[model samples]
Target: MTDVRSELVADPVGEPREVAPTTRDVTGLDELVVRCTACPRLVAWREEVARVKRAAFRAETYWGRPVPGFGPPDAALAVVGLAPAAHGANRTGRMFTGDRSGDVLYRAMYDVGLASQPAVTGPGDGMRLHGARITAPVRCAPPANKPTPAERDTCRPWMARELALLRPTLRVVLALGGFGWQAVLPVLDEEVWQVPRPRPKFGHRAHAVLPATDGGPDLHLLGSYHVSQQNTFTGKLTPAMLREVLHQAKDLAGLS
Candidate 1:
């Protein structure tokens, strides 16, 4: 377990594409992702948020580095999110942990039998995903939670490599928002599966079947409104709505 970060300090901007392709497994990929500094804006923003400290989290230390995906390597279902929340995953160092959005998302996942608990307080709270994995297109939190298209493209290699490594058992991808949906398509089309000629549109409950290019089972892509506070508080994405989508994803992934 060498400190890969040391190897990356020399050329932070080109590390993702350079390091991602060489990772042979999810564990290795996660290690590399946590060390990425490919986007200068993202790196600075994530670290600044960690330093400022939210009022309630002031006493606690923040995990300012890029957050990596969380779950078993052999997961059958993959959950793709936009990116780590400045005060959420960026604080806890785990996707969807220590945040309201995670509370909503995990509740639905628990109800659908994909999660071991209904809430995740932080990284070591014993929460776990069964036959599922959670990740994001961008590894670091961005200013205003909106990553520029260039930043998104720069971060694409990480997600692409992650999904490529998961191709053996991954059956269904549950995109948590339009951004996640758009981010995942090119990865599937160019790296793992054969996307349809006319790419599928993004909408809650939107579904698409991507034929596997390596002779594996077809991959199912399911879209859902992000479980962000804006959506949940406004009733745009209800708990029941998310549960329905999770249930559908589970069945499609052969987890149910």
Candidate 2:
């Protein structure tokens, strides 16, 4: 993967901008993410979606850019998702905000005492997370909510950097969906956590214990079905099920 700074930053209209790479701080990474235009298809699609606004949000401005991870920087737990929804995080500039998926996810976290509020309507809704953080494998809102393999690979370095920043304090990772499960393994491996041979398959409540290494803390990986409408509406994943997984994570992370 290339350095995040080498990746081109897209202008609002999908044009590349002239900018230097930044330092590896939470603030710098946040700025770098919104500026990323590394994937041409993602850049064009995200900009188009923003331009042709959703009817419900026509009067509002769209973020139409990469959505940065949100939560405590030194959190003990990290909840990862596939990517931003076209009308969710892309519209609100916060991961999982302004969507049914987020509504379900945050509510479950709140039930497990990880979140302060059950509803996450937007970035300014006063929603707060304690002891846990939420992020995604991909930052941009891909067309039809699916990012290509190339795009996923291209976007991996950002997630890698994110996990590296969180490695010191991060004790457990809750991966939502198979995409997030697959996405997190490589990042964990790069951080020197000993992943088992013949990798663990993703399933509801799938578990893997990555032992501590090189002074880094031991890491716990847990899997759950995504909070997408397709899954929730069809009853593939329910609130109680999601809350149970979060409760397990909270206990393992030693969060009250």
Candidate 3:
């Protein structure tokens, strides 16, 4: 893949802008999530899917509920993903769980001491991310795994609000794919997350160092290929490779 460059310190919107984190909108995150009914269609779809899938899958009864955010209440690294999977995180109400994708990601995280366990079926599964949190570009499951730009926009405020809440402690943002990366870039200070690449380009192992408006280079951005099923099956990503990236990340931020 080619290296995609962004003109640092510009608004994430394709056009130049003064503000960032346009995706994040609300505050009081945990409470806000419980009351989130912003996407009525998604709510109905999940409930309906649960009803039908229940009878069809007696042994694996549906969780039949809204998805909840995961990880500790406070974290330094935020892992942003594309969206929930119909049978995976969306069903389990925890990001990346109940799916092969989580299999790879959690295992890798465990190896690096980021997680205490290698499994995350949902809340209270005894899984913990000692230093991180996981979020999605779009909170709800989209039809056919493709979020229309409008749907993506609707979810942006939720994400933006979350970022604002975390501004005090967050040191790094890890984007799992190209879409996740784009979704986050918009919310950052223009001087930090700039774009010079053409639209719709996916990058791997990319890192950006941002200078803070508060007079420090505190925030760091890192990109990685998602631990998607396709990537695992094709050996596109491996444990050693991911470990190297984590080491580099820790080094970049002087974590270790």
Instruction: Judging by lDDT against the true structure, name the best candidate.
Output: 1
In candidate 3, stretches whose alpha carbon ends up further than 4 angstroms from where it belongs are 1-27, 54-57, 60-66, 190-202
As a whole number from 0 to 100, the lDDT of residue 67 in candidate 3 is 50
TM-score for predicted model 1 compared with the true structure: 0.94
lDDT of 2 by residue, 1-256 (tens): 2223322344332221223123356666667778777777887788788889899999998888888899988889999999999988988999999899999999998888989998988888899999998988899989888999888877877777777778778889999999999998987887769889889899999999998777766899999999999999999999999999999999999896
TM-score list, all predictions? 0.94, 0.91, 0.79
Candidate 2 local Cα displacement, residue 243, angstroms? 0.4
Q: Please give, for residues 1-256, the per-residue lDDT of candidate 3 as tens digits.
A: 0121222212112210112234342233544453344455655565555555534345665553435456665567778888777777666778888788987888888877778997666667889887678888676666566777766766676666666566666778788888888888876643333344443245678887655676544777888888888877888887777776666655564455
Location of the lowest summed lDDT over 10 successive residues in candidate 2: 12-21
User: What is the clash count of model 3?
Assistant: 20
- Candidate 2 colliding pairs: none
How far in Å is the alpha carbon of 28 misplaced in model 2?
Answer: 1.9
Error of 3 at 156 (Å): 0.9
Q: For model 2, what is the error of residue 159's alpha carbon versus the real structure, in angstroms, after optimal superposition?
A: 0.8
Error of 3 at 55 (Å): 8.3
* TM-score winner, 2 or 3: 2
TM-score of 3: 0.79
Error of 2 at 61 (Å): 0.3
Q: Which run of 10 residues does model 3 get worst, by summed lDDT?
A: 9-18
Instruction: Find the number of clashing residue pairs for candidate 1.
Output: 0
